[model samples]
Target: MIVTSAPRTKQILREVWRPLALLFVWDVVVTVVYFVLPFRAPSLPLTLFGSVLALFLGFRSNSAYQRWWEGRGLWGLMINASRNLARAARNFLPDGEAVDLKRTIVLRQIAYVHALRCQLRRQSPDQEVLRFLSRGEADFALARTNVANGIVDGTGRRIELARSKGWIDTIQQSSMERVLIDIANAQGGMERLKNTPLPVQYRLVPTLFTHIFCVLLPIGLVETLGVATPLGSTVAGLMFLAALAIGDDLVDPFANTVHDLPLNAMCRTIEIDLLQSIGDPAPDPAAPDKQGVLW
Candidate 1:
C-alpha cells in the first residue's frame, strides 16, 4: 500500500508520537513526586516487571508481523493461481476455439481478481469489472451478493459451454476445474484472514502490561538516577510504546490502508499479463510514482 521509502520514517514517527507524549507526561509527574514526597527507591521486583514487560512487547510485535506477512503471502498465491488458470485454458482448449475461449476465460479470471480486491476492501464492484463480461452477463453478476463468487460461477458456465460445444474434452474440462478449485481455495484462505482477527482480550493484556511497566520504570531507576529518573522513565516508556504501536499497526493486512497489500495493483497485473499471453494488446502500465513497495 505505502509506495515510497521516503514516507515510512515520517509515518513511524507519527505513529510513535502519541505514546511518547504520554511517556513524557508520566516522567514529569514522577519527577515532581520524587522531590515532593519522601519516597524510597523502587525494589528489585519493579526492575523485573520492567524487563518482563519489554519482552512481552517484543513477542507481541513479532506475532503481529507474522500475521501480516502470512496474509500477504496468501494473496501472492492467489496471483499465481489466476495466472496458471489462464495459461492452462490457453493450452488445453481446442484449436478452433482456442483464441476466443482463452481470451474469454482469462478476462473472466481478471474480473475475479478485481472483484475480490473490491470485496476485501468493502468497496462496491465498479464499471471496471464490467469490461470483462457481456452487458447481460455483467448485469447478472451484479445481482449476486458476492461479486467474486459470481465471477467464479460465470467461469464455470463458460467452461461447461466450451465442453458442450466440443471445444475441450472431459479430461481438459476437469483440469480446468481443478485450476478453478485452486483459485476458490485461495480466495477462501484470504477471506479467512480478513474475517478472523486477533482476539481483543489477547491484545489488551500486553497493552496493560506495557503501561504498568512504564509506570513502574521511574520508581525502579529513582535511587541511582535521582533527578534523572524522568529521562530514564521517558526512554523506557518510548521503547515499550514503540513496540506496542508498531504491533498494533501491523495486525490487520486487509483493512485497505496504505500499509496493506497492493491488491488493486496485483489484479491489474494479472489482467495485463494474461491478455498479453494470448496476443491481445497490453493495457498501459500503471504510473511509476503509483507503484507500491512490497514488503
Candidate 2:
C-alpha cells in the first residue's frame, strides 16, 4: 500500500494512462467531426445522462470502498488476536517449560502472520514459515493448499499438547484457545474477501457506460463550445475517467497494488509487538520507501 504523503505520479499514471490517452483521442475525433460536417447532438439530453452517470458511479465507488475497508478491518483484528494469543501464553504458563513454550508459540505466531501475508499475496512462504518451524513441519505446511490455515492448526495442536501436559490450567487453556478461534475467524473473513470479489457484470456496467459517455460527450458539447469543444470535453472526460479509475483500484484490495491494504507492514507490526512481548529485541518497523510503498 502507499504510505507516503505524496504518491509518485509516474507510478499512478502507469495504470490509468491508457484510458486517459483514449479519451484524448476520442475528443479529437469528436472535434474534427463537428468542424468538418456540421453535425451535433443535443447537449441538454446528454448533460442529464451525465448527471445520472455521476450518481451511479458514486454508488459503485462506495461499494468498492466498503469492501476495501472490510478487508483492512479484518487484518486489524488479526493483529490484535496475535498479540492476545501471545499474551495469553505469557500470562498462563509457568517457568521453564512454559518459557520455552511461550517463545515457541510467540515466534510461530509471528511466522503465522508472515505466512498469511504470503498466502494472501499468492506467494510462497519460503523463509518466513521455515524460520519458525522445523524442516518437516515447514515442508508439510508448504505442501498444503492453504499454508496460513495449516500453521494455525499447528498452533492449536500445540496448545492442546500444553494442556494435556498440565502446563497450563483448563481455564488458561480455554482462554488461549478462544484467542486462536478469533484468529481463525479473522483469517476466514479475509480469505472470504480475497475469494469473493464483486461481480464482473456489476463492474462492467458502470465502466462500459462511462466509456461510452466519454466518447460521446464532445459530440453533445461541440455546438456550444465551438472551437473549444475539445478542451472542454478533455476536462470533462478526465473527471469521469478518474472516477472509474478510483473505483477500479479499490474494488480489489488485495491485488498487491499501491491502493491495497499494507499487509506486509501490518505483519511487520505484529512481529515487532509479539517479539517484544516475548523479551526479544524488536526488528525495525516496516516503513515506506522513497516511492512511498510499504511492501
Candidate 3:
C-alpha cells in the first residue's frame, strides 16, 4: 500500500516522463500539419470537450482508487481474524490439549495467510508455507489445487478433533467455526475484486475523449500562436496523458506493482504476530529495501 507521506514530486514527475515525451512528438506533428494544411483555430466547443474529458479521467481514477482501498481493508480484517481465532483456540481448549492444539491451529492460520498471498499473486506456495504445517499435512496441502482452502480444512479438522476429545465445549467450537467462516468470507471478497474488472466501455470512453481533445488542440492554438502551436499542443497532451495513465495504473490492485497493496509484507506481518502469540521464535524480517518499489 502507498505510504501516507508528503507527495513525492520527483517520483510523480518520473512517472509522467513518457507522456511528456509523447506530448512533445505530438506538438511537432501538429506544427507541421498547421503549416502544411489549411487549419483553423479551435472553437468554443473544443474547449468544452477538453473539460468533459478531464472530468471523465477524474471519475475513472476515483473509482479505481475506491476498489483498491476496499481490497486493502478486507485484508486488514483477515489479519485481525487470524489472530483472534488463534487466541480463541488457545483459551477455550482443555489445559492438557491446549498447548499442542493451539500451536497447531496458530501455525495453520499462518499458512492460510501465506497461501492466500501466493494464490492472489499466482505464485506457488513455497517452503515457507510448508514450515507452518506437519510433513504429512504439508504434503496433503501441496497436492491440493487450492492451498488456502486446504489450510482452512485442516484447521476445521483440528477443531473437530478437539471437540471430540472433550478439549472444548460446544460453544467454544461454534465460536472457532465462526472465525473460520469470517476468514473464508474475507478470502472470497478479495477473490471477487481480483476477478472482476472495470467495464471496458467505461474505460474506453476517457481514452477516446482524451485523444480527440489532443488531436484538435493544435488546430485551436495554431491560428493564435503560429509556430508555438506545437508547444501548446504538447503541454495539453502531457496533461491529458498524465490523467489517463494515473487512472490506468489503479485498475489492478492485486498486481505486484509498487502501486499495489503490499501483500507479501502483510502476510509476513500475520506470520510474525501469530507465531509470537504461540511462543515460537519469530523469523527474521524480510529485506525492506524493495518494500515500496512496485510499479
Per residue, candidate 3 scores C-alpha lDDT tens digits across 124-154 of 8867578778778777677789888878987
- Find the candidate with the highest TM-score and give its number: 2
> Model 1 segments beyond 4 Å from truth?
1-7, 95-98, 284-295
> Which is better, 1 or 2, measured by lDDT?
2
Please, what are the lDDT tens digits per residue for candidate 1 over residues 124-201?
A: 875767877777767656789988888888889889998898888999999888888888888888888788877876
TM-score of each: 0.89, 0.94, 0.89
Root-mean-square deviation of every model: 2.6, 1.7, 2.6
Error of 2 at 156 (Å): 0.9
lDDT of each: 0.78, 0.84, 0.80
- Sort by TM-score, best first: what order? 2, 3, 1
Error of 1 at 3 (Å): 6.1
Q: What shift in Å separates residue 52 of candidate 1 from its native position after superposition?
A: 2.5
Per-residue CA lDDT of model 2 for 172-256, tens digit only, reads: 8889989999999999988888888888866998999998898778778888887788788888887788788888888878888
lDDT of 1: 0.78
Q: What is the lDDT of candidate 3?
A: 0.80
Clashes per candidate, residues 3 or more apart or on different chains = 1, 0, 5
